[model samples]
Target: MKGLMVKDLRLLFSQKKTWLMYIMLCLMMSFSMQGAFIVGYTVMLAGVIGISTISYDQADNGMPFLLTLPTDRKGYVREKYLLCLLMEACGAAVGIILCEVTSLVKNGSGVPADDIRSAVVVIPVMLILVSFMAPINLKYGAEKARLVMMIAYGIIGAITASAVVLMQDIMPDLGHSALVKIKVFFDETLGGTYFWTVPVVLTVLSLAVMYVSYRISVRIVSNKEY
Candidate 1:
């Protein structure tokens, strides 16, 4: 796992422009929104940048060589997910520090507790996104998987909008169903006390999804001729 992580980190840092772009983006975004949203965006950026390592390894027929090393297919997938988690941690940490500093400069104080709580949850959310994506990315290279994910998200959003708009007319109180739960969750996490449970629940859910995704990825890798 250590070697695999080192390899991906080396490949990831090889793209200096990506790091610079993220740096500039965070700096620019800091002025436009609060610290929590900035951290959320950074978390998503980490997920995208981390998954690109798979595409990098696929380039020039690199996977075969990587598998020939002292790592198996399952190990490779595990390391990829672990590497993504590491990237998320690093990105979130950087975002928190930057946000705190920016908040201090702007308001003469550090980031608020609400902002910190929201920022922490972004890591688990990004983990869920990466977990769902890594298998699709491994099965079909990054470019195609990216298009698929975009389309998938678009369709889901459209359906959700249609459901919320149309179902309310039929049920009249449909909005009170799921939205209430979400509102309560958000209120507790941001407004009320016990915000820490949000991260704990999200981390558990994310790990469950990642474990299922890992099993699927292993099957895909084992069945394919590499």
Candidate 2:
């Protein structure tokens, strides 16, 4: 598995695509995008980076050629998931750093620490999304994966916008009210260390999603001809 991971990472870094992404990410330093948006965008790009390896593998009958080695289908799937995790983590970290760097450059001050810290939650969100994407990519190859990701990204964006609009209508001050509610619920109602447990719960739930995604990917790959 280590060898498989190393191979994927080597292939990932070897591509000019990876550096092209880095250059694009760095260019965001002048944009006014906040930490959360930056984090989400980076995580998405990272997952796509991992998926690009699949395309490369498919180009010359690479999947069959890879299995010709000592690895099995399960190991290959596991390595892909691991690769996704690693790359997404890197992407999120880079996003956070870029957000801070950009904020410093523009305002001479850092971003809201709360917003920056909350970016960790986006990591799990991206992981789950990537996990969901993996099976489709594995089954269909790179071109379809690109198409699917584009569609998914659009759907998610639309849903997010609609949700924001709905919330604003539901309560004009929903944002402030929700913050107050959270403060009361966590700080006052739960108190002590329980407030921090929300993140733990979210992490566990995200892991569940990732696990299900892994199982689905395994099934998809196992049934594949290659």
Candidate 3:
């Protein structure tokens, strides 16, 4: 697992100029885009770059050679998730720093509370996105994964929108009552600190989804001839 991680990290960082360009792009965007947008953009870049390592591994019949190493399918999936999460962390840190620096330059103050909230919110969101990408890439290979991802995201968006619309229409009274009770429970239990429960829940949910994705990827890779 450690060897796989090192190999992937080296593959990612081998192109120093590409990373420098990515940093430059982020720096430029920080001046023009919303701070929250910059955060999402940087983290998305990190996730995509991390996913690209799988392509490199798949290229030139490299999978057979990689499997010949100490790692197995499960270890490979675990390493991919770990490497992607690490890159996302690095990206988020870079983004927050840039947002802070830009805010200071613009108004001589730190980032706004809303921006800070958005920045923190992007972490689990990006993790979930990476989780989905990993399994799709593992199943479809890098070339087909982009198409699969687009379709999957489209389906998810449609379903989410439909659910929101249906919820608004169906059992509105019951839903409102349930929501009220839930809010009351949170307010009674966590009081003012209930606001943080969202992120904590999201983090746990994302980790669970990532673990499931990892298991699926292991199955996909394990069954493949290579």
Candidate 4:
């Protein structure tokens, strides 16, 4: 597993142009985009970076060669997840720092507490993204995984639209007053504990998803001849 991790990290860092491009994009967005948005963007790019290493491993008979080493299929999956976590965490930290620096330069003040809170929210969201994407890429390869994810997104959007329409028809009061009531419920229920509870819950859920994803990937790879 340690060797696998080193190999993946070396592959990731070998793409100097890609990393440079991502850093430039993040720097540009840090100045222009919303603080929270920049954080999410940066972390998502990091996730992509981690995912790309899988593609590299699959290229040019890399997987066959990798299997010739001591690491097994499960170790490969675990290493990928660990690499993703490390990269995304670094991205989030860098993004927050960039946001603060940008705010200081532009407004002579630090970013708002709410904005920083929102920035932190991106970590769990990207974790879920990474978790969902990893096994799909492993099972179907990158090309087919893209199509699957697009179809999945389309289905999810369609269902959400249908649900919203159904809600509008079933509960005619689901407009302004209902929205306010929902907001009030959340605020009253979570006002004090919202900061810690929401993040902790999301992080735990994301980790669970990652665990499931890891197991699935292991199964998928282990069954393969390579």
List the candidates ranked by TM-score, beginning with the highest: 4, 1, 3, 2
* Tens digit of per-residue lDDT, candidate 3, span 1-226: 9889889888888999998999899988988876567777878888889889999999897998999999778888888888988888888888888888987887788887656665677778989988888888888888899899889889999999998789879866777888899878866786566667766788789989988888888899888887
Candidate 4 residue-wise lDDT, 1-226, digit = tens: 9998888888778889977887888888988886566877878888888887888888786788888899878888889999999999888888888888888998899888767776777789889988888988888888888899999889999999998888889887777678898768756887566756666788899989888888888898899876
In model 1, the Cα lDDT at residue 155 comes to: 96
How many pairs of residues in model 2 come into backbone collision? 0
TM values, all candidates? 0.89, 0.75, 0.84, 0.92
Clash statistics: count for each candidate: 0, 0, 0, 0
- Candidate 4 at residue 63, lDDT? 82
Q: Clashing residue pairs, candidate 4?
A: none
Considering TM-score, which of the candidate structures 1 and 3 is the better prediction for this target? 1
TM-score for candidate 1, residues paired by index: 0.89
True lDDT of residue 131, candidate 3: 86
lDDT of each: 0.83, 0.77, 0.84, 0.84
How big is the RMSD of model 3? Answer: 3.1
**Deviating ranges (above 4 Å) for candidate 1:** 176-193
